[model samples]
Target: MATDDLVVPEAAGAQYRETMPSFAQERFWFLDGLVPGNAAHTLQQSYTIVGPLDVTALADALTAVVRRHDVLRSRYVPAEDEVRVQVDAPRPVDLPVLDLSTEP
Candidate 1:
């Protein structure tokens, strides 16, 4: 297939808006995979911070977030390395905690 044919559906446009809840009232976060020559593939996560949250709960919620979105759980097919979106068990993601209290 031609290089152009390898392009996946654009998930950052108006079409995606239709699939997302109102950002004003809901907390939505995006996770993207590293795909060369393509725009950042985003996965929308439904998240809420209730008082003080635990690390385990944070991990669980992040996993749940990936589970809730097909793109985040997808893997690239072999051969031509074509992108394929799928529904599967949640993959573990190591998220780094950053301290942003320091001024730049």
Candidate 2:
């Protein structure tokens, strides 16, 4: 068998409109179906900011990060046969700011 003889059915240009989900994603989809509204698989981080903090700048930075990463704005579609990951176009993200500095 030659390398040129091999062909991929899903191959379509440099960008992919939709692709099959990875193993991890498939597992997550199954888990989600088993138990909806479960946050066990979610990852979160917290940080304490000291002194003068620019909330607007922070929100802007976070939104920029979300826009840069396609996975951040992706949607997983589970079909009867398989699961697919669809990446949406880059768009501005809504970042809410909280003023917890006034707390005692």
Candidate 3:
């Protein structure tokens, strides 16, 4: 069975727009239905940098990187024949507050 057959078709009135997925991205798109999104198919890394933390700077740097790489902020749509990828310009992302200071 093809991946497209697994996904529900879009609405008739819905606007359809997307770019063709790269070869690498296409491989993953085909496996999307076969494999779970939460499952690990690639290497995983955990990082812990100890120092006077600069959250603001870290977030800013990440935002800049996102703006530079379209793939980082792109959306994917699977079609019967091919996979579609769309990218929109990056915008400011607000960080939510989480105070764990009281936790033991």
Candidate 4:
């Protein structure tokens, strides 16, 4: 029934599952569902630049960071008994544009 966190197809070999979630990870995961849309545990910042940002470079940087850190590419999977981390290889991502330029 579980499809490797629904990211990897069941036909795509065996999914790699890491160890169980840490205390902090478990706590945060619980709070995430208990308080959806809460930003208390999140860190967000905005930047103002004078020129257009290289989206390609930004994507590459994000992918690189994910590749370098296995935790970033992992998610907790709950099953019949316990929860474990499922880590997958980094995939390419294309940034989406809002095109708010025309908005008044």
Worst 10 residues of 3 by lDDT: 8-17
Alpha-carbon runs more than 4 Å astray in model 4? 1-12, 30-38, 99-104
How far in Å is the alpha carbon of 16 misplaced in model 1? 26
Residue lDDT tens for model 4, 81-104? 556667766676557857565689
Per-residue C-alpha lDDT of model 2 across residues 2-62, encoded as one tens digit per residue: 5234322445553434656667878998889889989998999998777898767877887
TM per model? Answer: 0.35, 0.63, 0.66, 0.61
Model 4: lDDT of residue 36 = 79
At residue 34, what lDDT does model 3 achieve? Answer: 74
lDDT per residue, candidate 1, 1-104, as tens digits?
45345444455432221122223212212122233444444446787555665777778888788868755654433223222332344566676766444768
- Candidate 4: residue 14 lDDT (0-100): 49
Which 10-residue span in candidate 4 carries the lowest summed lDDT?
Answer: 1-10
Please give the lDDT score for candidate 3.
0.68
Superposition TM-score, candidate 1 onto the true structure: 0.35
Better of 3 and 4 by lDDT: 4
- Please list the C-alpha lDDT of all candidates, in the order they appear: 0.46, 0.71, 0.68, 0.70
Q: List the residue pairs that clash in candidate 4.
A: none
lDDT of 3 by residue, 1-104 (tens): 56445444545654432456677887887787677584556667898676566778878888888888878777887667777776555775565657565799
Clashing pairs in 2: none
